[model samples]
Target: MLSEEITRLIGKSGEPMILEVERGAIRKFADAVGDRNPLIWDDEYARNSRYGSVVAPPGFFGWPVKWDSPMPFFSPIREELITASIKAGFSRIVDGGIEYEFFHPVRVGDTLVAVAKIADIYARETKGGTLVFSVTETSYTNQHGVLVAVASQTLINR
Candidate 1:
C-alpha cells in the first residue's frame, strides 16, 4: 500500500551503487542457493571448461559486496528493494519471477558493480484486489566496466 506519491517518487532515478564480487562471496552464494555445481566449486573442473578458469554459477552473479560502509544500498539491491516495498506499505510482496542474460562468465575474484534501475511499474486488478507489479533491471559490470550479466526481477505487491 505505498502511497501513490511515494511510489511515484520511488520511480524517480537514484544514484547507482557499486558492489564488489569476490571469490568467497560467490562460493557462499552458491551454498546458500543450494547449487552444488562443479563449475562453481571445483577449480580443476572449471579450468577444463570453456571459461578456462573458475566459473561462477550463472545465478550467483547477483551476489553483492558487503563492505563496512555507511551506505546501506551498497549491500544487496534485491533485499533492499523488497524491504523498501514492505516499508512503503505493501501488505505483502513476493518475487514473481526473474530473468537473467549472461554476457560473460563471472569468475572468482571478479570485482563487479551492480547498477540497478526501476524498469517498469504497473497495476492489475485481481481477485484479491489491485496488485502492483514492479520490474527492476540490474546490470553487473566488472571494474573495467565490462558488462557481465543483466538481471530482471519482477515483484508483485499486494
Candidate 2:
C-alpha cells in the first residue's frame, strides 16, 4: 500500500558516490567491529602478507563518510527503503538480514565508489499479517573501476 510517489522516489537509485579510503578510517572501523587482526592494525605484519599494505576488513566498506556535496536523495539507503514501505501502507517493518560478497580487499589509499540499486521488491501474506520486502544491492568499486565488494541488504515490512 505504498503511495506511488514514495514508491517512485525509493525506486530511483542514484549514481555512485566516490570516497577516499584513509588509514585512520580503516583503523576506526576495525576497532568499531572489535576486530584486532594484525593484517588490519599492524603495517609491519601487513607488508609481509600478500597485500603489501594494511587492508580494511570486509565489513569496513559499509562505513559511511561525510561528503561535501548535498546528500543524495536516498540518504541512508536502508532507512529510506523501510520508510518508503511504511508510507506505502505496511504497519511494521524490521531489518531482515544482510548478505555480502567480497571481490577484492579494500586496501589503504584506494579511492572507492558505492553504486547502489533497488534490486527487488515483493510482498507476501503470512500468519502474522502481510509482509513486504525490499532488497537493495550496493556495489563498491575502486577508482580503477575494479569491483571491490557487493552488499545486499533486505528490509522487511509487515
lDDT of 2 by residue, 25-113 (tens): 88988888888999888999999999999998885663445554343323365456666777667858677898999989998888888
lDDT of 1 by residue, 102-143 (tens): 988777777777777777767778887878787878778887
Pairs of residues at least 3 apart in sequence or in different chains that clash in candidate 1: 1-89, 1-90
Best by the lDDT measure: 2
lDDT of 1: 0.70
User: For model 2, what is the error of residue 125's alpha carbon versus the real structure, in angstroms, after optimal superposition?
Assistant: 1.2
Worst 10 residues of 1 by lDDT: 5-14
* Candidate 1 wrong stretches, greater than 4 Å: 1-3, 7-11, 66-89
TM-score computed on alpha carbons, candidate 1: 0.76
Error of 1 at 71 (Å): 12
How far off is residue 96 in model 2, in Å?
1.2
Enumerate residue pairs that collide in model 2: 1-88, 2-88
Model 2, residue 38: C-alpha shift (Å): 0.5
